[model samples]
Target: MSDSPHQMTPPPPEDEVSGWLRDRRGHFDQLVSSVEDYAIFMMSREGIILDWNRGAERLKGYTAPEIVGRHFSVFYSDEDRQSKFPDKELEIASAEGRFTVEGWRYRKDGTQFWASVTITAIRSESSAVEGFLKITRDLTEHRATDEMLRRSEERFRLLLESVQDYAIFMLDPEGHVMSWNNGARRIKLYEENEIVGRHFSIFYPPEAISIGMPGSLLAKALKDGRVEDEGWRVRKDGTRFWGNVVLTALHDSKGELRGFAKITRDLSDRQQVEHLRETGRRKDAFLATLAHELRNPLAPMLPGVDLLLHAPHDVATVTGIASMLKRQVDQMAHLIDDLLDMSRITAGKIALRHTVLPVREVVDTAVEASNPLIREFGHRLTLNLQDELMIEADPYRISQIISNLLSNAAKYTPPEGEIALTVSEKPGPMLEIRVTDNGIGIPKALQHSVFELFDQGASGSSGGLGIGLTLVRTLVEMHGGSIALFSAGEGQGCEFTVRLPVITTSAPAATGETPVIPSAPRSGPARILIADDGRNAADILGLFFQMEGMETAVAYDGEEAVKIAANFEPDFAFLDLGMPKLDGYEAARRIRRMYPRVILAALSGWGAEDDRRRSAEAGFDVHLLKPAKPDDLREVLRQHG
Candidate 1:
């Protein structure tokens, strides 16, 4: 009934105060001891350290007794302390209820340490002034690792940008160019913005696109993870080049393809080099075959003709042997000369010696040179020359060109066909020379490649190396002129016309009369030596010389000719070029070295200006082409003797 007289009375104030203090102390202990790495401490409302925990003692190198009651400003460096950062931090924390930052802080020993610090304004039940609870963790190693990783990424980006040889770029899933670098811009001629959203098929040529190569390449890359190809590619300007292209499909960790990476290289120069090398190889093989086959037939003709001319054979037999040897040897020699000339031209060694000459003289020489072949073919020829027509050109070479055209006309035309050489001077500053023939005209399709070396027309039946016209064009071009072929169609006959610019003529002297000569006359010949690789050519020339009553001997090469000079002791010597053991040039040198008095004359199939110059420098007094006329040979011998 008394209700426990002790319980009825209110609890004592002292007991209540003790219990509250105990509760607050328990909360502080739980908070400080539960910490793992952060240092936890208590400060007064004035920022003085009221308490320090084990974590604070271990991390800040401060014992409780040393840190207690000390101003929290001791955690700051001297500069920060002077700037009142610690006080400012406390004020901010109190105003905002909390403050957090990462900065450098000083330890008890004054060594600076990187720290992430959080300052909180501890509140009481009435929300009045209370101390601050600070939690801090060292952040030096983590910050260093992060900085190092950032630098490494920068280096990787720089490496990608510096590459220049390959056009490395990225594409979207649908094969759109997503990214381009400097190499891409240089190789594809597409700027970054211009190519960013364009389809990759723009790089393919029209022919490639017609065959669906672009789309097929993308599909192959998607299926196979990668695809590579080499072929012609197009640029922004519509120009084409050989390109090596590679496409690689890029994927993510989930095994789904993200996009593609494309790399391309310009291979135009490489393709050109490969093509030239292959062409050179083919040319070499063709020349070798031509040499072997052409040289075979001339072997028997040489000794046979030699024995017939020297033995006690009847005049008819000797004459017949001489004619066969001369015709066959002349044909074979022409083929060899063409091959050699083509070789020289391709090597860029053909040089021309230009001069001003009367066009009539050139035409006359061409006509006379082709007379034998014309008569053999039983073709009628007509010549029409303008009296004063003149041109600036290499006279001998121009003659050779005209003669080649005439002979070609004669060979291709039927018996009793008509061939005409007409010369006329244009009003301006050019002379026009035309050679027309009634023969099997060139087909229209062959005209495109008619001037190409070794493109023999319609193989087998028409026998020629297809070099004469090419040579004609080259020579005409060198003379600052042009040559063209005109034909109605095959079997409708063809005509070739050359137009050469003329040099202004000098004023004529006051001479009253012009000189003329009779056509029927023979120049006397003296002693001469004949040298040729084609024994048929050598024997034929020897027979011709014997008929002209000039002492002569046959030597197959330059070395033999040099030895023969000691016994024959001739006043003049004729030598052929391109012989075995030693060439005519070296033979000429050796002959001049042994017998400097002998007049060395070169009788060769090679007749280019450079060839003639080389002969002259090697001590040849004169250089003449193969299939030499008896009169020309006699004239050469007489001039030297």
Candidate 2:
């Protein structure tokens, strides 16, 4: 460094060079040069490098012989040079005695590196600037790490700011607010500026704070890493809300406690629901409700169990019966299980599995589930398919909807009444289904509340758990549809119209079972014809009854069965209504003429009052929904006696 008006050690003798650099043994240079991590050198006051040490050579990729006496501006980037920044450093150092900066600098290879450079002005004893001492350190790696950390922190900040639901923030070791997020601001009703650095206990109610809740929570989190609580949290406006809070301990990699992270969620709606249930609703008398709910699932199962016990050991027959019973039982279970999913529905959590399916398949499946109830009422179900169409919907929920409506109709309808299910396309892309029943209809006054929770009907005949219609309406709406009820007056007829969205989906109109018209002529007429659509259902049942002794003739379609009965003249006749050529109804009517005193049992899918009346009119002494059970065969003898 050349001496300037400023002095390096007040400038040595005027004629002699400064001893700082003019060392006889080169010891001063050796010490500076040995430090490879720093570039230590001297520069003339005019900004030209006068000497370069080993550290400078190593850091700038130039040897002393190659770089000595070169202008220091050569190491500065083009932008810095264009702005005269290198000269400015010299000027600032000349005037202020020292200048320091961290910026981009270049090496001998022209590659850029972050450099911390300091320039110190040296002056002669006469107060004239002579030279300068400069030092440079490579900080590229350190700068890179700092930049990466800065970006990560920025992203974390943005993520917290964007959240709007959960109140998330940070606390200091003593529970003072360290940071606040957008969610925290919204939920706690506190601005970031107003809340940060404040004690977290302020958010707690006076009682809670008096009890040391905030301090205790911090302690628990410090010990356990996390603590959770559901309690009242006071907001900025002094209003209180039910909140679910989680306090988690934050720690460094060294296992030292840093602070805490708090997350709060508003749960006031849930608390309000609990309060309403406590105050407005009363469900203390629950025994009858429990019985009704349990009875729903048991209706289709008990008969099957009784039959299987007394059934003969025919593998194929037993397998068929078991499989059928299992399917019916599974349907009942699935439907009843849906009724228990009200909690999920109310919580906005029930999801539907939508699929393109045939309307006939859906209708048949729902009817299968409601068969027991329909038969119990003896209602004649008439299905009218005005339009064979395909529908897009959640098959399970749709089945539940239709089954509920059918079950309700069966429960309220009178014996020997009529129930009809009609499917057609509406004006738009909607599939309309109407379930009409001529039974105990809803009174005009109670019709509006029928779909309300637990409002079954005015009559005691609408026997059920009373959640069916409510469930049906909810399920119907979930499929992007609506359900409506209509009835003229009591004892008239009730109708439910459900309109559902119909997507342009391709599917065969009828992929379900083919309806059978009564017809009988087996491979060989053995004086008996047993007809059942189920594979081996009739054969297995007939074989089982035969092993019990007595000449019990298993009949097919009512009269097709009667034709065989004419030749066989069996005293006991078991007839299925869905026979070919002649149904069990007509067969029974025909057979009763031939043998007036014969014991006849009508095998029906359901036994409604109307069904029993029709069977009796057809001359059947007894009718059973589950005709496969031993109870039915035994019931035949019991009725005869």
Candidate 3:
């Protein structure tokens, strides 16, 4: 291929080049004129204004025809112009390529404004200085904002130092004290200079410092962003005070851990001591009364045993003694049950088992349980119930509530007294149950405390354990309901109204009663095992089952029960939860591994929901409280069958 000479393109004529340059300059001028925020113009090397745009005209309060050709010194302050500072700015920009400054400048009207100005030398290709391009921007609003923020910071510092209650301070990332307010000095009895370099652990007790509590707390706050604690804090005087402290982690804008901000409040001992004393007084009174009540039950039991020993052959005399003892035992059991319920309520350990139940069924159960006591007192009982009312409640607790009120009335009322129970619907999604008794009414002064724990208001000999009303109110509230007392006077009658939220007015499913299981022992697992730490309890239960024609074996502890299960492999096992030698839960787990299908029951005196949950976790099918009624035990067996 033949090589071709490189094609050469001729440059445009000077006239055409001048036209293109003019076009670009016109575009630049248009662009600079539209800018409103900045004053832009061209100035001579001598600091005289050579060109002006719309922005410069707007900023300087002069049109292009009026301000052009004027020296840029007009924008400077009088003192600056007198000092030749305007000329100095151009000279510096020409030598250094650019110069920038922020100061006060004047408009054509002679008003002053804060401004930021930059002057840049327009240089040729050989770097020779030409005219300068100046840009001026208004900064008045920004300066005002910065000044206001500075004043605000000063006020906040004063306020923090003036606070007298809370001890506010700052710490470095290493937990060394950095800043202290006046409140910190007052509360800790230490001057700022004395504590600024000290570790925050100085405020904690010696024991806390020995265990690295302060360092650990700082780490926790750093991790969790904030932490609150209350404990004894030491003062410089060596006295200790209970302080509630809050430590908040401070962070920078980049989310980096900066330090900590701490606030402490002194909860002085006087108020706490008074509260504790009142609590102790109530507890002491309850213990004394409990001792007396238990003694009353045991006192008659000893005499009854003597009577039984003397009248060994007389059936009538023995029956009377047995019945008397049974009543006393029942009374003691009732007292204990109430105490347990109250404990559960106060500890927030009780979880209600709610069911959609008809109010009539609950009322009927309560009335039946209370009839014997009512008949013994020769009291007239009346009931007024609305039909087809349903509620969501723990059925047992609901009945217990009514039974307690009824028993209280029977115990306090004179013979042949009248008691009334009325259940009616209300306007809202609520229903009301009222129990009234023509008994010694509550005194006016004591009405407010009638439902408090261990309250002795208007409670004479017939108060029972003095916690029935408290239990009633707690149970009612748990059902999302409320209870109130109404009394005319001491001589008149008293009424307790319990209002409960209703689930529905009528529903077929709710109206249907719970399935009835026979209380008599029925066909179930033939081979059974019973284990307990109490030999008498275990043997008696075994004997009772054997009498009912079931093969039964008894063990005194958990280890023996597991050994028996290894060979005997009973179809049903009732294990006392508090057994020695490995305990019931472990025994149940081992037995379950051997016979996964075997039914396990936890028999114990402690019947909290947590206990039941633990039993369930250990593979027990049921948890029965101590002194399990014959009827309850039979129902358990029937389910298995």
Clashes of each: 0, 40, 0
Give the winner by TM-score: 2 or 3. Answer: 3
Please, what is the whole-model Cα lDDT of each candidate in the order they appear? 0.76, 0.75, 0.82
Per-residue lDDT for 321-356 in model 2, tens only?
777676665545444454456545766667786677
* Best candidate, lDDT: 3
- Candidates ranked by lDDT: 3, 1, 2
Model 3: per-residue Cα lDDT over 134-173, one tens digit each: 9998888998898799889889888988999989999999
Q: Which ten residues in a row have the lowest lDDT in candidate 2?
A: 2-11
lDDT of 1 by residue, 1-641 (tens): 12221111111233322333334645676556545477887666777665566667767887666666678888888899889999899899999999999999888898878889999987777775466788888887887787789889778656656678878888898999887877778888888888899999999888789999988998999999999999998888888888998899999999988999998988999999997875676457556656655766577687876778577458787777768876777778667776677777777787776666677778889888789889988899998887776566677778878888898788778888999998887766777878999988888877656566655443322455557778878877877888888878788788989887754484333445333222123364456788888998889788878987887788998788878977776667788878889888888888777666777778776677677888888888778876676667777655544
Q: How many clashes would you count in candidate 3? A: 0
**Error in Å for residue 185 of model 2:** 1.6
Alpha-carbon shift of residue 570 in model 1 (angstroms): 5.5
Scored by TM-score, the top model is 3
- TM-score, candidate 3, is 0.55
Please identify model 2 stretches exceeding 4 Å from their true place. 1-25, 123-129, 251-257, 270-641
How high a TM-score does candidate 1 get?
A: 0.48
RMSD of each: 13.4, 19.6, 20.3
Better of 1 and 2 by lDDT: 1
